[model samples]
Target chain A: MKDKIRIASGSGFWGDLQSIPLQQVTKGQIDYLMMDFLAEVTMSIMQKQKKRNPAAGYAKDLIQIMKDILPHIAEKNIKVITNGGGANPMGCVEEIVKCAHKQGIKGLKIGVVTGDDILDSIDNLLKHGAGLDNMESGQKVTDVKERLISANVYFGARPIVEALKKGAQIIITGRTTDTSLTYAPMIHEFKWSWDDWDKLAAGVIAGHILECGGQSSGGNFLGDWRSVPDLAHIGFPIAEAYPNGEFVVTKHENTGGMVSVDTVSEQLMYEIGDPTNYITPECVADFTTINLEQQGKDRVRVFGIKGKPATDLYKVSMAYNDGYTAIGSLTYSWPDALEKAKKADEILRTRLSDLGLKFDEIRTEFLGVNACHGPLASEQNEINEVVLRVGVRSANHHDIEAFGKEIAPLILTGPPSVTGFAGGRPKANEVIAYWPALMPKKLVHPKVEIITT
Target chain B: MSKIKLIDIAHGRSGDKGDAANVGIVAYDDKGYEIIKKHLTTERVKKHFEGICFGKVERFEMPNICALNFLLHNTLGGGGTVSLKHDAQGKTLAAALLKMEIEI
Candidate 1:
């Protein structure tokens, strides 16, 4: 077994930078390249696309990325793992195969992990006593059964490790946990036991640190953002992992971003609810027990991560057709920008109200004033400009469409010095709201299939 | 003790979890961590974000990283695609919290 391995992050989300994967394979001696391309709402979007076309549900950017990095990764013997498969891992694999064939790269074994899409099995599972209740709202899955756009289980690193052991050069999956993409490599290379809670937790923590691509390596850094060098060419983070359940988070040589203790610590706290109970299918990682030490410039050593046994439940990400929403904005300039914007908002709302138009919610914000911080925003007087943005959400599509028509009329009739209305009338679009639930582990089975090019 | 902005001694980031928003505040040192730990209670955080956050505030400690995570429920109007707010995912909520004045 290898004593150490280098795992590099290629992309963080679905629309992340495409060139970063190519840079990762060419600029460094990395053993594995893991890219995460799924988010909570991405599956529903991909499901909508799949309904339109059978072979188009996966992340299209992955094809372009594969076309760019296939040759370099093939030459360097670097394996790849990603959940860019979205709603259709098979379709993603087909696209990757075509890209490999176009590049004249032969003998590539691609692994596809599926069975996570449980939209068809939802009813059956519910009948079998799996209520699939919404974790937040306590509503049963039956309430949103007809409106579900997508429903997929979150798989862990087990299937990816199985694919790795099967000699697959690349692994594609649907709805796999973002951390599992980074953690599977350590398990495969080190031959770590499945029951090693502490080791698995250490791997999970490393995965969490590396899952955001460059976030741990100075990208989107909150601490000393100005001190980070060359963010324009920021280097994504890489994990220099050892067999002893320890790793050093660093980037490649001659890279621009810094991987300091501050940057890594900030990422560790990102989007996490309870640090002590970070649940995954593999293990329940305890983030409170983590130990981080800055070894050198662009190097932070992470160790002493503890984890508990796996839970019998798997989290389910479901998206449904929530409603229709349309947003439009008009910029109002000084001498009284905020006042003008507020006046425009009031006029538009009054017009809608007078017309007897009904909506579930009509929200307005003066962009330059308090849009982000809301009431916490400090008062600003004598502002140069403020964008009067108004949005309406409702079950009625006509109301949203009608709300869109009122913005441009305000430019001429409601407020003076109003402009920047270039995008024409805002059209009503479907809002795919998220529904997070849980299912029994015994019901969901992850399937891994190896295909060769 | 003098009045100082929370940003002077701590840095943080925020993201959404369904309708709730979580802000993780990390102190620059142990002294700063202790100072914020004593003063930055969940009640204070909820009060600090009165109009924005509409639900209960829960705080979790991570003394290893010298950080505290505050989970502000029902803060995003509905979160995800349903919310019609500019910062639907509460990405800037941490920066908003940092603007609060604290006695140090």
Candidate 2:
């Protein structure tokens, strides 16, 4: 078994820094480059793209990054894994083959992991007694099946492990869990047992640390932001995994940003509801058992993670067309700016009410004051300026559009000293509402295929 | 001893799951964790975010890591791609949460 292997994170989500993958390959000696490009709602956007053009659902940016770093990774024998496959893994792999062929790189094998997408099978699954009820709202799938744009079950690392075993140099998946991309390499290299809960949990924690790219480093760090240096050149996180299930979280040698116990701890808590029951497909990791120590500068060793067997179900992320929403804002300057903004909001709401435009929801925020904290903001009488932002959501398109038109009128008729409306009228946008559900693992299966050009 | 903002003694990160916003508050030290455990109750946090969070606040304790996670249900207006707010994902909620004052 390999003593240790370094897995470097490139992108946290789609539209993350483009130069990040290049830096991971050029600046560091990593065995695997893991890029997570999918979010819970990204599949819906990709599905829309696929509806417009069947060959264009995947992350097009991944092809460009592969073009930039393909030759270097090929030379170093560094494998690549990503969930950028989105709605089309085959189409994404076809593009990557063309890129590699154009660059004269030979014998490169790419693995395509699919079958996570279940948009087409929603009706069949529903008929098969899979209610797919909303885990949060207790609503059935039939409630929004007509408007569903995307529905995909989140696959875990088993298919990825199979792909690695088949000698796939690059693995592209549809809706795999983000943590699996980093842990699959550890599972493959160390030959870790599938039932080894502690080792698997340790690997899961390592994946979580590196999953956010620079967040585990210092880019979005909230702890002593001033102390985190050179965010412009911030280094993405790297997990050096050992056979014993202990790993070191660090960044590139010359790159900026920190990898301390505090940073890792903060990331461990990001987006997680429960600390002990951090669930994945392979195992249920207990983050409370994790132990961290700052071994050296820009390096924190993590160990002692425990886990239980995974549940019998998989979480499914589905999105449907809810309604239309448009938001417009106007900045009111000093000399009772807060009061002026409040007055403007009242005027706009009164106009909407007069027009008899019914809306599902209408929200207003006074920036430079309580926009973030709401009632928790400390009162300030001497504020220089405040931006009055108003948004409306409704099933009627004309209502949201009319609300958009109301903002421009307010600049001239409602409040004085109003500016910062240079973006023109806020256009109505289709609201893609998320519906979280679960499906029995036996109902859906993942497929893995390794291809070489 | 002095009264200080939570940001002085603890660091936090917040993100959204559906319409719920979760803030994970990690103390800098054991004493800081004790201070947070005593003062930063679910009621206090819900009150601290009055008018923003419409649902109940559930706090989960992680004494192993000296952290407390607060899940404010139905807090993101609508959350994700549907929410028209600038901070739809509640990324800035953590910074706002740290503005709470506590005695040490």
Best by DockQ: 1
All DockQ scores: 0.90, 0.75
Question: Over the stretch A309-395, how does candidate 1's per-residue lDDT look in tens digits?
Answer: 999999999999988999999998988899888888899999999978999999998888899998887778999998888999999
Name the runs in model 1 displaced over 4 angstroms: none
Native contacts, share recovered per candidate: 0.86, 0.69
- Best candidate (score: TM-score): 1
- Candidate-wise lDDT, in order: 0.92, 0.91
Clashing pairs in 1: none
Error of 1 at B75 (Å): 0.4
lDDT score of residue B36 within candidate 2: 94
Where model 2 places Cα greater than 4 Å from the true spot, the runs are none
Deviation in angstroms for A154 in model 1?
Answer: 0.4
Candidate 2 residue lDDT tens string, A273-305 = 887899899999998888888999999999888
Tell me how candidate 1 scores on lDDT.
0.92
